[model samples]
Target: MPTPSVRRSRPAAVRDRRAAASRPARREPLSTKQVIGLILGGIAFLLPLVLDVPDLDDMGERMLAIFLLAIVLWVTEAIPLVATAVLVIGLEVLLVSNQALLPVPEDATAYSTFLGALANPVIILFLGGFLIADGAAKYHLDKNLAAVLIKPFTGSARTTVLGLMVITALLSMFMSNTATTATMFAVIIPILGALPSGKPRTGLALSIPVAANVGGIGTPVGTPPNAIALGALAERGYHISFASWMVMAVPLMLVILIGAWLLLIALFIPNGLGIELDMKASWATDRKAVTFYVIADCVILAWMTESLHGINANVVGFLAVVALLVTKVMGGEDLGRLSWPVLWLVAGGIALGDGVGATGLDAWILSLFNWGAMPALVVVIVMGALGLGMSNVISHSAASNLLIPLAMGLATGIDGLEPVTIAVVLALACSLGMSLPISTPPNAIAYATGEVTTADMTKVGIVVGVIGTVLLVLFMPSIWGALGLL
Candidate 1:
């Protein structure tokens, strides 16, 4: 017979086993990629500190360290993207700002200047956009609008795919690509299930992400890369208003969206297969939802008519936030649901660009290349290609952050290269990078559905990305100049 202590010990062991079984599994603290990134990032950070480059000052060296560390971390995602962003700001304050721990120049940037990036105008605009998007999701406005708008294309499988693509793109223009893809997928999952599991399902799955990714290029608030470009341009005293961005990009967005739709139909969608969609729209009728609708419309209108009201877009964005909070349309929970990490990520880019410009790092880096010898068109093509290629493997905002400052520097070095043209090209090119599941969040979401294979996404993505980049590089600038859009 067992003693009392032994019996008690057995029960305790069982309890421990139960507890272990009930708890969620924990991931390793550092992945192999993360470990490699840390090692490489550390070396990159210390290189500028230990070795002096000719004509590069102390401040530039510090910023260079931060920039190099950022590249490695963002590429490998050793840490969260937002964490890297905040780190950049913190380092700027400690190493190069007016409050530097080391000796500094008289014109060192103010610490407040680095911290103030959190409230940059681009961030304010994104805050309003996030609030409105969240409210739309909460009120079921996005789904209802998509359902109602997709009715005409329900006649056939091909047309229904087109309709879905069109609605997805339209929503993505106003909402984040990830959100738009999620909302559309949620509505269409049943339809996708009803169809045979093959090319048709794959095509339908692929359409949402492709449309969302392409649609993001349509406006300033459509994507983070656009905000990155806008923030950089603002630093250079060149303001491209919301309407102006639409004027410059909507045509390309339409072209690419339609092309992708056609490609999807040809590749995966089979003809004569009828797709029956339940197109009933149950629009919200309650008082709170109605109030939200009014606020969103007014905010978007104000953003579009900045030329008429003379109220800065940033101020208008804040107005929307104040109106929503004051009216109780969105409470504390809704505010908490906003994409705070994204906002911080954009802030970090702004701070990074500011630091690079302040330290003359842009000129030092630009001096390494003979940009003036290249034709303006070739330079633009190269910048666009870099943005497109880098965005495929890293975060789109990260790609923009790394490239836009350099593009600005190139604008100064190359004769006849307009900052507006190069900056806009780089921004839009970043949006065109969706050739893989890892290219963008929308693509990742689409791949997660298990309806499409990586090969499926890669083939379509490569075609769309290449075509879109070619159009953007070879023709858009001429069109913008002809229309006086620049």
Candidate 2:
């Protein structure tokens, strides 16, 4: 009895119902936290226009507001971190670069001013690091390396814990900490499951993240925060060679790693000391893998001898990229798997720092601080403490990004405080906040295994973070002075 139109409408309605049934439900509206972030961001944008600080010019005031807003958003994570990064670039383009607003003479266009951050040499260094990591992963190089490093001491539980910690640390020095933790996580689950549920099982699990976090400090490419600090220092005409960084970082990491091992033994002593792990190196004879290893070693050798070769670290990274592709050790897909989001995040930080320098914001901020009166050691402790705290709450790279410019600003104000030293301290401190699962990727990865709880991590993290900071404070001055950095 229905007309053709009615029949068509009925079928369409039925199809719509079926489609809706298959799809997920509508998500809830903005959370209270997100709404609060929006409000704070709005306030931050508007505050500088009203109450102007003495040292801050109109543009400096506006940039400060934006920076504060960014800090709030980053800490709260109301939006994606990448989105906040984009917001930083966008806001700088509008608020700082706009001719009607606070335009600078150097900026030909707003886009050009901020866009160049994506191609920063430090960023390129990261690109090379990513390629190497991907290639290593694709070729099972990390696993093989881990197997070789951990194979020797699989006899006793205490020795096994040490071996796992050492292997995780060593692998993290070259690959992504998250990847290293995940790789080691699978290796240890069976061993952990074999043991009774108690402190020892928990301690072994906790060691992976602590070691990974500590180990990342050992290499520039080990983590994004390291690259951020290195790049910022380079921009200020201070450069630490790849080998030079390891010279300082490796010794510190070894000390902390051993301390962590002892703490685990003391706090969570294993009942059985006879658990054997099958750590025999696999893929021993793969020619392609060997080729990858050889190329990587060659690149590392060049990096370590940068004093003799005088090749820039980023250039070495590029060479590694070319060598890997030419040798067919890495394919196009492997390159595609690199952490583009993280790169974007770092690029945003670079852009923000560049803006700070270009716009005189750094000078204005430095003027407000009375650093001349403050002790240099106290300054280091404060910065280190702040870096450690911020990294625990937000992304480590984000924390580093926020602190490095401030540290540099402090360096300008504080007589006899080396900018490079402050930068190094800030970067190292960023890695020290491993007390919470959210502090770093490696921590989260281990926590995901359910063998370790948040309480377990928090307890270990607090001690490790505090001790690490204290040690850096004690040794960094002499170390940097020896390197002619102070």
Candidate 3:
């Protein structure tokens, strides 16, 4: 027995170290997806040169096509987004060789457009928000917060869903919708899983997305479309602040939530089928982490709201990034691993806008749409419809980044509707939970729980999404009238 002891199997730490060193490097043979990604990547980078597309001045049309191909790969997720972005860089090289895309007639210059995207204020804001969320998770405050917050609903189904919706809506005022959902998931989904109570009746399924949608509406940074609209409008010198955004956004959220309540009641839940509130004391076990994260969130909110003197919205976001660096919530290496592809895509979109502006094509595109002469309400309806459809087809971020500039260009021709605001309303509403599984991340996230089906979301979401589109069109004019924002 002593001879066979073998020193207790080399101890857990030693065994772990040896096992890690001896590990077979995962040996992931190229998968079909990877193969496709490589082929497409090669085409995107190599095709423009062979095709002999000539670059006229700084036209960069070939680069644009290459970028499109790269984005297609990204959206398909055949490869990682960053990889797709790198493919864009490589294509930039080929396009430059043929003198078809590079503004500076060189590969390095092609990166100017892309690097511009990475350096933007909004992209940086995403980084800051992630850092804050990371700090929140590190201390396990998210779980503790959820445990304490979830205790209040007791066993009632409707109340539990309602509580989550309300909390998500409130938290989303300053955070991105995705980040808010991720945070809320940490707090809420576990409770859903642990329920000896079981999955929510049919009412529980629809209610979660409804709430998530409502919560996401009230903040400038809750979704990208909101940011795009806000940024484009601000570029035209319209000074919409956090408070001003909420003054309008709050009512929009209220209308949608009311509709959701009615819809939920009409479906599975009786008007009488209600949930009871819990009076249990909270258990925020990671009190220390919560303290750090909350302070950081407050700082961000203050900057976003411009509540403090000498600190504006854009300035605040950068400060948060700096805080992330100084506090070591995440390392530089981790930051390097951030979604730079999406960042580059944003840049590509913005550069496209800049390109259009430079070429006087923005004016031409606007004139073609002929949307400038339409009534404000008509424009609202059209923009809303376009937003919902395009978001469902592509992605919301893509639609806004691509379309808002065109709208901004056309605004000069309109008499009443502020081009940027209409764009904002359209862009902000882009994250609707509608018919397709691929429409929005929230739809996918909630659907993947396997508790809800795509068809269920589609049936209810179509009615609700259409209703939401109408709500925005009708409400914007009324609220803007009251606030004189239009």
C-alpha TM-score for every candidate = 0.94, 0.90, 0.76
Poorly placed runs, candidate 2 (over 4 Å): 1-29, 50-53, 98-113, 284-287, 483-485
Q: Candidate 3's residue-wise lDDT over 1-486, tens digit each?
A: 566644456588798999999987876677786787667766774564456544323334454455457545655556654555455545544453333343443333334543454466655655565555555555655545555666665555556666666666665655545555666664555555544342344456456655666666676656666666765665567766666777777788877777776776566554434455433334454545445675686766675567546566666666776766666655677577554555555554555454444444466556556675678678777777877777775666766666676767766777777765676667666766456667766666677666667666777778777888787877676767777766
Candidate 2 lowest-lDDT run of ten: 100-109
Which candidate achieves the best lDDT against the true structure? 1
lDDT of 1 by residue, 373-452 (tens): 89999999999999999998998988998899888988987887899999999999999899889999999999999998
User: Listing every candidate in turn, what is its Cα RMSD in Å to the true structure after a full C-alpha superposition?
Assistant: 4.2, 5.4, 5.3
What global local distance difference test value does model 1 have? 0.92
Tens digits of lDDT, candidate 2, 1-486? 976664568889899999999999998788898889888877876787678677777777777877888887887777888888878888788777744355555642465767777788888888888888777777777777777887777777888899989999988888878888888887788889766787778888898999999989999989888988888888788888898888878988999999999998888865456777776666745778889888888887888899898999889998888888888878787778889888888888877787787667888776677767898888888899999988888889889878898788788777777887888889999999888989988888888878888988999999988998899987867876887645
In angstroms, give how far residue 384 of model 3 lies from its true place.
Answer: 1.3
Better of 1 and 3 by lDDT: 1
Q: 131, model 1: CA deviation in Å?
A: 0.3
Sort every candidate by TM-score, greatest first.
1, 2, 3
